[model samples]
Target: MHTLAQLRAGELSGITRLDLAEGLTEFPAQIFDLADTLEVLNLSGNALSSLPDDLHRLTRLRVLFCSDNDFTELPACLGQCQALTMIGFKANRISEVPGAALPPLLRWLILTDNRIENLPTELGERPYLQKLMLAGNRLQSLPPSLSHCHRLELIRIAANRLSELPQWLLTLPSLTWLAYAGNPLETEADAAALEGTAHIDWSALRLEQRLGEGASGVISRATWQRNGQPDTPVAVKLYKGEMTSDGSPLHEMNACITAGLHPNLIRVEGRIGDHPEGQQGLVMQLIDPSYRNLAALPSLASCSRDVYADDCRFSAEVALRIARGIASVAEHLHQQGITHGDLYGHNILLNDQGDCLLGDFGAASFHATTDNLETQALQRIEVRAFGILLGELLERIDSGLSDERRKVLEDLQRRCCQPQVLARPGFSEVVRELRSL
Candidate 1:
């Protein structure tokens, strides 16, 4: 985090990255001095409403972040930076995305928590585009040209005003992770069904050590006390209550409650009420200590896929066990009008015995079960995501396995990842095939 004084004094002239957050209402001209060497720039958490027209001076910049600012539009000068590939303007008041504001080499673009109502057709023209975050916006429809995004993978369009899901979005070849909850198109049945969860007052819980934290909230180990009942150990997630890149915390909590309980899913005890600070929270069954994340989050190089630890290896039997467990839970979720949009290995936990549990409702969405076509397409899209995970698991299988057995698993992965959208099998079919193996 560089200060204006250092920049003005030319002390940061040779740096490759610069971060400034002094609440300036205008661009600092001194930043141009590092244009020759700067590769990443962050000006987030400020009151800035515009950028310099000559932002192209940073010819070597590859990543730019201006989240939590006051910008009402994406700067057009960003298009001239030939090396810029990643741009983020999250939590801004942006209502417009000019066609000429985007660079051709863009790969990751985040405009979450904005007021944008439409996207440019040129967004699909970027051949290298992969990750796109557009949740919490006012979009009514998506451009048909987005179908041309062959390299696209992760996309979050939740909390928008879209009247219907785009058919072209369902057929995107490289799409793996997708979320569209909190839209008008969501079903009433699911909304009503998601309510009536048990509520626990915040004062009754005794907080313990911190468990973990994610983009939406922080989890902690706690002990719940009842008037006549014995104390119970549980895991509590207190949401930060802000619009995240994925969607709102309220929607995630609803999805988690609607999902109910299954052997393969983490159990939700109840929702937390009367938080001292008015924050939303949930009380869930604490996972056993033996369980650990199956893989790490994706790296810059891998872009959209999970990266497993190098020393990890799964036996053929263990891989099948993990596949069957996830397939079973996914089928259950779809049957309840829910889609676990972010079903990656990084979200799954497993024990040495190969028993797996799928958790995290941050990217889950609800769809109308009566709308068969749309529901089927939505499920198939998630099937592709699961297939990608399955393929990754298979890649870590022990090499000494029989060639015939390995061939069977490889063939199943190919079928799951088929580019012809509807041609791919559903989770139920996937489970059936895995059981036969």
Candidate 2:
């Protein structure tokens, strides 16, 4: 959060990164003074709409962020920065994305919450491209050229206007995480799917200590008061009223409600729709305090993979239990027409007894349960995500399994992660196989 005064006074001459956000409407000429050393620049939370013509002069710049601004178009000069790899222009009014606006070495691009209708065909030419955040946009379809991007791993097209998901995405060898909620093409949840979800009133919940916070909502420890009965301790999630990196918070709440009872799922005790503050929320059964996140979120270097702790090790028995729990719950979710788009270890909570619970509907999406090809392909896509998680857990084992058990687990992983999308088995099949082990 640097000030324009400090930049103008030459106080930040040798800095490698700069953050100036005091309502800037135009690029500061003084920024060029440190072009020799600057690598990352953030001008977010400002009023800027465009960049200067000579932005290429910052030869060392590798990352740029201009989110929460008034930009109507992605600046073309940005593509001239030879070293730029990551760019963010979220929460803007951007409707135009020029073909030349893509940087030469791009890896990650964030354009969530914009009005984009189409993408530049040149985006497929960036071989290093991996993560793409395009939620809350007006895209009718994806460019056919995107099929050339074999390295793309994670993508979010939620809240868009696409009538159907491109067939090419199903066959992409590397795609793992995907979210497509809040779109017209989405299948409506069956009326009977949410038959027993209780409508909890806001006044019944007494919020207490904060449990955790994420981009879409805040979770807190609370007490669920019962009429003429004992109060029950619970966990409550109050959704934020804005587009998240994944998609709408209301979509997540809806998915949670549609996802009915599962032993390994975070039990949704009730839904809170009439909050005094007009916020949407959920009342859930409090998970045991001993259970904790299985792994940390991805680091800068491990861009799309979760990072585990140094001491994170599991026995073959414990590993099988975790695998079985996840497979069973995943089978249940898809049966209810819900897909847990983000199935990373970070979204799971576990205890020493190998009891695991899958949480986080922020990236979940609803789809049809009909026995159609499109529905089958969607489930198989998520099978790859599960394969990635199983692979991660297997790699962390300290030693506790027979060679035969190890071979079975490895083979299952290989099948799940195979380049051929249709070769992957469904969650029910995965559950049966794990049960045999």
Q: Choose the strongest candidate by lDDT.
A: 2
**Model 2: per-residue Cα lDDT over 231-310, one tens digit each:** 99999999998998899998888888888888999888988857878888889999999999999998655878999999
lDDT, model 1, position 86:
93
Give, for candidate 1, the lowest lDDT window spanning 10 residues.
Answer: 187-196
The TM-score, computed over Cα atoms with residue i paired to residue i, of candidate 2 is: 0.95
Cα misplacement distance, residue 62 of candidate 1 (Å): 1.2
Note the clash tally of each candidate.
Answer: 0, 0
Q: Score candidate 2 by lDDT.
A: 0.90
